[model samples]
Target: MARFVAGYFRSGRIPIRGVHLAVVLTFSLLAVTAHAEFPLPNHGESVIVGGDRAYPPYEFIDKDGKPAGYNVDLTKAIAEVMGIRVEFRFGSWSEMRTALQKKKIDILQGISYSEDRSRTLDFSPPHTIVHHAIFARRETRPVRTLEELRGKKVIVFRDGIMHERLKRMGFDRELILTPTPAEALRLLASGKYDYAVVAMLPGMYLIRELHLSNLVPVAKAVVSEQYCYGVLKGNRELLSRFSEGLAILIKTGQYKEIYNKWLGVNEPPRVTKELAIKYGAAILVPLLVILAVTVLWSRTLHKRVEARTAELAQEVAERNRALEELRRHQDKLIQADKMASLGTLVSGVAHEINNPNGLLLLDIPILKRVHDDADEIFEDRFREHGDFMLGGVPYSEMRAEIPRILQEMQDGAQRIKRIVNDLKDFARRDDAGQKELIDVNAAVQTALRLIDPTIRSSTQHFAATYAEGLPPVLGNAQRIEQVVVNLVLNACQALPGVDRGVSLATGFDREQNVVVIQVRDEGVGIAGEHLPQLMDPFFTTKRDTGGTGLGLSVSAGIVKEHGGTLRFESAPETGTTVTLSLPVPAQRG
Candidate 1:
């Protein structure tokens, strides 16, 4: 290397540094020239191309009635990069082959290369190889070679290359023909023929598509052929353009994509030691140069990067805080949308429940009368026949029980009716009546009755008590009742199972000059974080089962309107207690 530099100076040539600059300039120029050279074009009319209509993963018309398949995509890609204008035509395979012979089409997109056809067509280098196979029913004895197919009734695609080959091999007399490879395979799978001859790829493709599980490739790759694009012999200009475009596709990675899209399942490119070393060195040398340049570049900008990073850190913190606030607002908005029909839902509930309770209220009285009238007959039967059964209970034991059962049913129905009436009053859009002295006990009792079914279904242990002489609260009675009903209903819903107990109690808080109603439940309670949002609109834990968090929000609104305070106390899995405090009249307090 030193001698070469010295010799260059002696010969009055450029300096070593100048030579290095020249080399870089030369490479840069070459890269620009290569980029400019595309897209290669035949500056004439569009090249008319033809292909077989039935061949798939290569060429065919798709179900959408478009000219499609692997060959179509590859041909389009080739045309794009090569700057070629092209038009496609598809028809029967034999018709296309004859079209090429008679100069009806300029090129065939793909054809299996054969020495006999080479005289009439110039073939591009093979893009793919097709191995023909003999397929038979799975139960058939495996035939390993093509020669073994003699004298057997073999199904072959009519006018296909396989048909011509079989004719030459003297099996023409025994051949059963179909128009397409798929049709041939179907015929073979129907058990009508001894075997089917088709390209291995199309055979496999069709078998899966037709779900012909009984078919198997008995003889593998009996013959393989180079699949290539073909044009009339000696049309070197058009043929050469295609050949170069195909080579360019392979050199770049576009060919790999198209190949993998269709044929990668059958054949993945095998990696060899030589290929690994060649590509590894090609990739590594450029990376090493980049690394050295990056190190030098970073050293010069280190101070600026550090300054910018500090600014970015502060900005990120501000952004994070803003994002958290925005997310909370967004959650409320989304939840509001989900609960849009809450008013309608509550009104519908009240109406539906009112109907059933009305039936109970009317029927229970008649049932009680019927039982009373039948009591004497039942007693006489007992007297005559010693303790016979009555309603699955022995008459002796049932004598006292029937009346009690009737009374309890009557009481339950009446309570349900009262509750439904209160629910309806709350559900009325314009039922905000004037404030008055509300009996906390009476309001709570009516509310509890309203949710009797929910309470019964939720917990077996439930009880309520009213203080004998608690001062009345100054509020709209219906509005106050709605709040109590919502609170108790929520308490009932919070209980995990029937075993959990819920209790309600009313008392006068003499020190605070308030009347208080408290509802408590042994339930899976609210978490500390959630307690803060209990009265926020659209914040229910039961959203999955249609809980419109608005229940508590609406309840809170009523309490606020009546000059009362709503408070919650709870811990997860321990239980929750909700307290309602309403201001008592000054004289009463």
Candidate 2:
């Protein structure tokens, strides 16, 4: 029967009539069904078939706790054709592969054929073709090809064929490996990832079972792989038998039935003139009746539309007025929010400056008194040396102390000046619209100086490391400083004690053509629940400590405006590292 069917297919002699095709299929099925009692191979009476239980619709544990799916059924059918008993073992993909290598499992179903695997194993003729698809949010633009996904945050099953394929295609940098496609799709739906590369059938099954409505297949399959049963390299007889059984299954239309049951089949509709005419006649009277009624209703609808149009115009005008009012309120709210944030920063700066101001105030009067007394002594000239010792100190000691006092006052004044300058730079709104080529190392230093007071107030050790020969970044210096200040301030706040340390580092990312600034803190770290919302506007973990939650959000915005990315990696008890990556302008040299 298998030989006859193969001959027919090879002859390209498909029956043109539906009845003839049905008869041929029925005979082929019967012939293959009779061969179900064929003798098993001498070496093994029962074969062990292994598959990944996580792969749905192909091989997975059903609700009945029994191994089930298309591959399971297909393997069973093939085993029956070869008159062999089958024992199914289910595990992870890697575990199953190891089992196959160890000879614990005689065959592995639902495995994609690869040249590397062919070295140690013999693959049966492919029973089915698996197509890989890119799944992403429905709102995202469709990514039809692999090239379109360059640098996209993609998720794929770890060690799966798609993962290897992506790595081979030079997308290893962007992949976020997951243990299964379901997890990958879930992450994609949650916006943690930009795309998921997975087999279409299993991906669709998971989306339906999990009810992930936000995601959809981006486009047609980006890759198609042949799935076949694998046997040990020396098991030539078993490989041959499995191939023959699979061919018989196909010839008898059993394979097609299984394929359709699991992954839906798309059949073209047969449109004959007679059938179309018959169906057309059946609806022709109703169509004419509806048309006549529609003509009459059109006149009434036109009158109603005129009235409705006038009403809609009035409603639109009211809506416009409401929208304008809303916009005014929004603007006011935004301004208020900005002012509140600015007020908080100003308060911190004021507290920092107050200490220096107080020192200057106390020392200025004492220094002036000493100077006056010394002038009087000098004018007398004939006065004894004791006269110059107004503060009970020798004249030489007084002269040295006076210079030291003036220097202290000057340093204090300079400290105040630097604070005010940093404040002025931070508060400049015009910096957002301006771009300039500035040294990133200088920016980091300035930010460190501004935040040094905050860092010193805590017992946290602070350190800065700047890489030599770093290229300048194209951005507003003040804006970059703002980002660094926010990150450092957040790091300081996260530290629970003086034993922890915060480090700021700057270097060039030569491959990506960007300047990287990293702020790492050995602090309490962020909670997992808060990581997703870490950059959300008004989302704060330090609300009790006067945190506006706008620090990270505003910082992220500033970085983005400068064509850069702000990312954070944090784990509880492991501390956090926030990285600011800003693109470097093209070098003239």
Candidate 3:
């Protein structure tokens, strides 16, 4: 018999090892002697066992929809040995508990031990032990203990031992009770809950059955629960019968057979120190040889890795130097772009200043003439009868002419002030990069004023249309002004002669919820081929005219940065219209 048992173990059919075989053999001998004269209970009818209908592997409806599983199989084996027939009643766990409590069912299988339940139910000796574990998304850190689940969204089966345990542990604030462990795990897999508390075997089984790839069991078991059958309190006879039958099943090896069939082979029993010592020398001899060989191999590999790491470090340094040189070249290009924009504005500014300066020069000669006339009048008054007309003209006429010349000079100075203010605003540095609610119409008007001189010199008719009650746009005011100025300057340059016209308009695009600014010019229009490349950096149709090609490109970039668009529409000899559509600020009550 000893030789046969050793052969059975070595075949790997049973996972048991070491001292466990002795325990099983001892119990088997006791079971034969104890069963010799054991009396069977006399129940008038079939024993009715109650279990959850949906729970799998333990108790559930099978493919043919009949009640089945480990608990069912165990119950049938116990009944067969006790010389009685058994029936199964499948329902919700709550219903099963109610039926068992009301004496409607003689047995309740797959129930965990609980203090409250002991008051109304008599539990049999535990048939199986289940370890409770935390189930969470695979990407989440493993929750090794119950305390780690605190402050996280935890789902548990309603009325289950896990729910009661969490409540006792003061985790009620984070607990979400579901109808079943399957439901709780489903919620956890869907990311609706952070973790689920459930038995390890059932959770793993359900995860595979449901094909929930995201859910995984944490490595550490939180608690272990003994699952047993229950009967009504004071039904000591039925509970005693169940215990004896279960003992018979275990002693006969039927319990282990059923467990292996449903849950897979049990892990090998722990090795004893005597068993370890018996095999110690066999294991240690090869391990020492491997260790010595590994040490020599590791030394060689370490030197190779050191050499490779040094090569990688040198390569990294070279790449960084190349990147630094590229950055410096890019900075030069940006500076050149800025100088080009400044050069384009300088000509328009000079023309604007010249007009005001000319008016100031004209006022100088008028002042001189007024002085000469006043001097003549005073001389004539002194020479002739003390009230003589000045240079054969009336003093009233001289006074009127003096006031008119002074008013003209004042007007000219005001015009010069406006032109200088516009230029300063355009040239102001916007380093802060702050954005605020801006009036698009106001920005359009400022651009028109700044570019007025260039427009007059390049085109005959210039018109501006402003829409009232337009919605405000959120952007950097200075940047928006720059975009408008670039567009208008481009339009002025596009005009072929003074007969061409330019128009600037501002309005709200209600459908798109944006503020629209349009600058149209009747000039030598752009060709279709050039239109696509108009916004490309360093691309321009006016290259021969000293265009640096950054105006449209830079303007388009600015518009995009402000969450807006700069689009163009043009036909040969017809006109070119550049439209800017900027998002409006969300209204606040």
Highest lDDT against the true fold, candidate:
1
Q: Compute the lDDT of residue 299 as modeled in candidate 3.
A: 56
What is candidate 3's lDDT per residue for 506-563, written digit by digit as tens? 8888889988998899988989888888887668888676576666766766787788
Candidate 1, which ten residues in sequence have the lowest lDDT sum? 1-10
**How many residue pairs clash in model 1?**
0
Per-residue lDDT, model 1, residue 319, is: 63
- C-alpha lDDT score of every prediction, in listed order: 0.73, 0.71, 0.70
Residues 1-589 of candidate 2 have per-residue lDDT tens digits of: 2233323422335322222242335443433443322233465657888988789988998888789988998888888887778889988787888898898888888877665566776555556667777888988888777767887898998878878777876899999988778888999988887889888888888888999999898854566565767776656556566666776777788877877787544212344545667774764565456545655555565556556656666778766555556545654455445544554455555566567666776777787778777666664653553323223222433444455556656665665555455444444453367788899999989988887888898754788899999888888898888888888888888888988898988888889999899999998888989898987656888877656666676676688778899888999989999988989888687
Clashes of 2: 0
- lDDT, residue 311, candidate 2: 69
Regions of candidate 1 where Cα sits further than 4 Å from its true position? 1-44, 267-589
Clashing pairs in 2: none
